[model samples]
Target: MAWRYRVGLVVAAVALLGAGAAQAYDVAPHRAVYRMALAKAASGSGIATAEGAMALEWGESCEGWTVEQRYRLKLGYTQGGESDVAVSFATYEAKDGSSYRFFIERARPGSMPENISGKAVRGPAGVRAEFEAPEPVKLDLPKDVLFPTQHSLAILGAAEAGQKFLSGMVFDGNEVEEATEITAVIGKQIPAPTEGEELLRRPSWPVRLAFFGPDNAPGGLPDYEMGIRLYDNGIVTEMKLDYGDFVVDATLDKLEKLPKPGC
Candidate 1:
């Protein structure tokens, strides 16, 4: 998986659940930690083992929402090789969903380190982005494009309304030139898990999100997919990351409620 995009998108789903929910969705500011391990591997997948950890903090501000995430993974191959990947991501989205700022740093074996930072705003014309690192560039996006936080709310909104499928374009600042098309499949709501934090006790749904790249053909396979037990208040109890050849499971290990903004 492209860890940069993977980590960024993961945060997009988990951190922004505060804006949408069933029956007057309440905002939740919290911190979470998850332990990741390989759940399965396809034949000849070349993946022998995988283990990782992810830490995320979601907080509310007077004017916007803030999220910080750190992720690390170590992969062992059948052929006796290993790869260690680490990524740190942060973003802020205006409460009104009109502006966003992001920064990401990633390191992986055999690849140049990546550093990305940018700010984007929505205007009558469309979404505009101005990058500040790895070469500055200005770009315009589709008028209908949604930022990460907005996209998450849209998904939760659909779930609350009993909709099963929704698709749209989203810009998470992982790419510089264009936004991605995401198709979400919302499963029927189920009772919350019997364990974990109180936040996890709320009703949630099984959501599968498929991300398609701009270069992908219409109706083609997605670049990657994520399965999450998404709570109404924007908490994820668990996650499954599917990369076609292998699947990784992320189990929530720690969750803590955060104080709401005084404003």
Candidate 2:
């Protein structure tokens, strides 16, 4: 599998959000833990078995919004090789979508870790990025694009208004901090089901997103696909990742609400 798609899991939690008028979304600070396992493998996927755990924590401060995402997966491929993959991604994005700072690191057993750290700002002219790792370079981002949290909120806002589909571009610090085409499908919104402790307190809807990059040639399929149940407060209760070759299911194991940062 391609490195981009493999590390895409690092930013997976930021892909589904709302962007409609039916309801107002308030970003909630919370920590979520997910138990991951392979659901199935395709004909020539080379994947035999897999297991993993992932965590995503979102917080808010005066400077911007902060996110911490990490994953550790063990994969056994049919080609008779095994690998332990690790990924860590962190970012701080401004509320008004003006600036973003990101750091991403990926590693595999017996291999040196590779990292990308940079900052990007959006100005009237356009967006620009300066990298500090994997060699220094400047990148020009798409003028019309959203960062992870911004994109997620857009999805939520739309679902609240019963919008079925939205088309846009998003930059989640993937390969080169470039924006990738995104198509989000918002499903029916319903009240959060009552639980013993009532861990959730807002309405939620089903969301499915397809991500396509420049590398994905025309008429070709999206690099990856995601399906999730997103809460009105911007928390995901359930999710799945479809990587074309294989599919993985992430079940919410536990969740904890955090205090909002005060500046």
Candidate 3:
């Protein structure tokens, strides 16, 4: 799920240089609330029911973009048990994608909270990262790796260009070990639905993102896959997370614009 959270975006409308389109593609800063529930579950999956809520606050700063995400999920098991899971995640990514800091905490019944905090810097040599929590360790990544925001921008650019496929390795602070390989399938552009709020009444695309683990071979089954109705303005109105045995659906329940930084 680390890769899932990394898709979160922040900051005001930053221009996409070399995106090769006349239309302005700006990412809006806002707080989005989503209601989550089980869309489907395979038999013998043991998952009886699932429901939850997620709140994501994305804002901008003078030097970078910031995000705070809270997720709470209640799962009912067929064997007569329930588990409540909560996750708190925060991140700060430099405007140039040169630096990133992240903190994540996850808690569940009868288990101690697990916390991961770290920072990474991308330079000409490559990406060097240091973790200060749960343990002390260092890592280095390939120079060609893309950060989270950079990955988002690349997807937007590809969609605008009518490119149906894009793939890359993305490093978000969530997976301290290594970057995750991502393959994106961009679908045809869709006109905005007339039933949503004003902010959602914009053109969008059906984008499917497949996340593969480091050891997965080419064309192997992805560790996780998500489908999103991604708008041109960088807003996601709907999402479906597929976990093989079960699928969770997220629908946008509320949206609030965040004030942009003076810088």
Candidate 4:
């Protein structure tokens, strides 16, 4: 359920920023591949061992920024057989964070594939999300909220300012209901990432986020937590996904810079 953390990160990492914006990190278009493995599983979770791979490509189009993400996880069970979980998602987010359109699908063993498609626009009141696939429903966004890319940039800015704790509301269209309550703790800035490739070794910070729903939150335990080794340019070199019952670690295996449109 907290897997929305990963989904939001993918959306946040796949966007364009117009020039001359005051931001702590410059956004870029790139592709990243990660090797993933289950780090831990609580008892009775029915998980024996799991391995997966993820690939995400963020590129700019004439109309907006485009994102493509694919993930596959093979899980061997303690009781019996094995199952593969697959998810594919793509979206377009406007440079100004005023709107977003997304398409997502999830498939698993012995189950019908689930699909969601929608668009959202920000107005004076707040964001209004409209869903077309699965069903038609409208969801309300909170006030003073940030979209995916804006949320990422805000976190980076706070980290750069040496602020250790930050809180905000973020809407990534990962959920069909409401926005997520985000609380982040930023660690000291590191001059280099020891295990990262050349392009990833730049100044960065360690960030962790606890995500929750709006109701009874801050008092309620987070549904999930995510830790990231985030570079100044919105690239995450390493990540830990904590799903309450289980945890998974992701390592960036390949990184490639994509060509940007000439100014």
Best by lDDT: 1
lDDT of 1 by residue, 39-151 (tens): 99988889899999999998888778788999999999998988898999899988766788999888887889899889998888988988988789888987778888677
Q: By descending TM-score, how would the candidates be arranged?
A: 1, 2, 3, 4
RMSD of 3: 3.8
Cα distance off (Å), candidate 2, residue 202: 2.3
Q: How close is candidate 1 to the true structure, as a TM-score?
A: 0.91
- Candidate 4 is scored at a TM of 0.87
Q: After superposition, how far is residue 64 of candidate 3 from its true place, in Å?
A: 1.2
Per-residue accuracy of model 3 over 1-263 as CA lDDT, tens digit each? 22233333321111232223212346777789989999998898888998998888877676677878888888898999888888888988777767889898888889999899999898889988889888988989887777666676677888888899988877666655787888888899998779867778878889888888677787889887889888776678788878778888989999998887785
Candidate 3 versus the native: TM-score?
Answer: 0.89
Q: Per-residue alpha-carbon lDDT of model 4 for 49-85, expressed as tens digits?
A: 8799989887765445677888887877789988788
Off by over 4 Å in 3: 1-24, 193-196
TM-score winner among the candidates? 1
lDDT of 3 at 143: 76
lDDT of 4 at 249: 88
Q: What's the lDDT for candidate 3?
A: 0.75
TM-score: which is higher, 1 or 4? Answer: 1
Clashing pairs in 4: none
> What is each predicted model's overall lDDT from 0 to 1?
0.80, 0.75, 0.75, 0.74
